[model samples]
Target: MATWAIGDIQGCFDEFTALLRAIDFRPDRDRLWLVGDLVNRGPKSLETLRFVHSLGDGAITLLGNHDLHLLAVAAGHGRLRRGDTLDEVLGAPDREPLLDWLRGRPLFHYDPALDMAMVHAALAPGWDLATAKTRAAEVQTALTSDADGYFAHMYGDTPHRWDNALRGWRRLRVITDYLTRVRFCRPDGTYDMRAKGPPGTQPEGYLPWFALPDRASAGTPIVFGHWSSIGLVDGHDVYALDTGCVWGRQLSALCLEEGRWVSVDCSARGSGAGD
Candidate 1:
């Protein structure tokens, strides 16, 4: 069996199909690991969601910020903003099954056999691999529960930092934001919602999550998207594959087994930087 971990799709279904064909993916024997943002911003939000849903057990997807936004909007915690392209998913006749399946999907995925973990965004600093796996599950449980009261508190900043003692909906919100929306965090682990660029441009007080001291997963290959500005930083066992395909640049795919990286030119990727 072969496993390939690809970067953020962001609704560029055509680019994704090209990548899969280029890799000659064998559905029966190959497993695909997607780093999330499977929908929104591109022209094929519905198609992207449906395609990944069709993959079923053959694919492993870690929830990205956009994915979480879709879930929150579905559950009534978030409101759609301009440029959001998830209307089809929210109104589909199969909405129930689709949202149910999506809400239950893992936010952070790790395969010990491959010595790799894939997340939509970077892991919080100070967390080892085990810490990430454990904490990720905690929020996943809350989000997947019928008592999704957690969604009500999903827009806050108090629980922005990890606290083992955090309980209930607030805890779930913090966990969700970190796992899904986090980019740069202050040295004390507080997230800087205002900063949204490469580590070099980040405010002086913040650091990239992976660059923090004592980062246990520094040796384990961690695949993530959400940072097209950082592009493809090949260091400390971390890879950033969101080359802003939805912004009309190029879509990227990093083949885990072959160590082969491919980028396909795109005309409709995300152009909203400093966004």
Candidate 2:
């Protein structure tokens, strides 16, 4: 059996299917690992969600920011912003099932056999693998327990840094941001959530999370997305699989077992866009 790590789908269902076909993905014999953002910002959000959900055990998906946003909006905790394209999903007949499946998904996934982990975005510099897992579970418990209350407080860019001493919603917010929205971050562990460009565009003191000198999770291969602007970067023991497929780029997939990559040009477009 083959294990393939695919980049963000972001509602680009056509390209997603094309990439799967290109890789000869057989649900019976192959397992797929998705980096998340399975819906939003591209055509066919509902279709993308349904197809992935139908894959059942053949697919393992970590929740991305968009996925959380969908849940938030569905729970009446967040609003649909300008350029948002999630109406179809919100109004779908299967919305509850889809949303339920998504909320049940974790913020992080690890395979002990592969010594590999997957998150929607970057891990904080201070979190070793064990710490990362424990912290992820904390946020997951909060998210699944009181989703309405969780989504109500899920937004924001502060406290800007992580502290184990942080409590309540503030702690969960920090963990969610780091795991879902982070890109450029300072060595001191403060996030630059506004920086969305490539590596050189980071603010003066900030660098890509993985590039930090003291990143504690550097020991494991963390496959992640949420940085479409950076496209595909595969070094420093991390795999960035988002190839901007929703922006008319390519859908990417990496064969983790063989370290092989496969991509297919995307043709979908929609009003919404971002990392």
The pairs that clash in candidate 1 are: 245-269, 246-269, 246-270, 247-269, 247-270, 248-269
lDDT (Cα, tens digit) per residue for candidate 2, span 1-275:
89999999989998999999999999999999998899988888999999999999999998999999999999988999876779999999988998999999888999998889999998899998888889889888987788888999999888989998999999999999999999988888999898988899888999999999979998789899999888788899999999888888889999988999999998846322276
> Any runs in candidate 2 off by more than 4 Å, and if so which?
268-273
Predicted structure 2, TM vs. truth: 0.97
lDDT of each: 0.80, 0.90
Task: Give the worst 10-residue stretch by lDDT in candidate 2.
Answer: 266-275
Whole-model lDDT, model 1: 0.80
The number of the candidate with the highest lDDT is 2
Alpha carbon lDDT of residue 172, candidate 2?
Answer: 94
Q: Largest TM-score belongs to which candidate?
A: 2
lDDT of candidate 1 over 1-275, digit per residue (tens): 77887877878889889888877788898999998888888888888888889998999988788887888898877999888889988999998888888778888888878888888876777678888888889877777664357667777667668777888777777777777778888756788766777778888878888787776668898988887777787787888878888888877877787777877778764465412
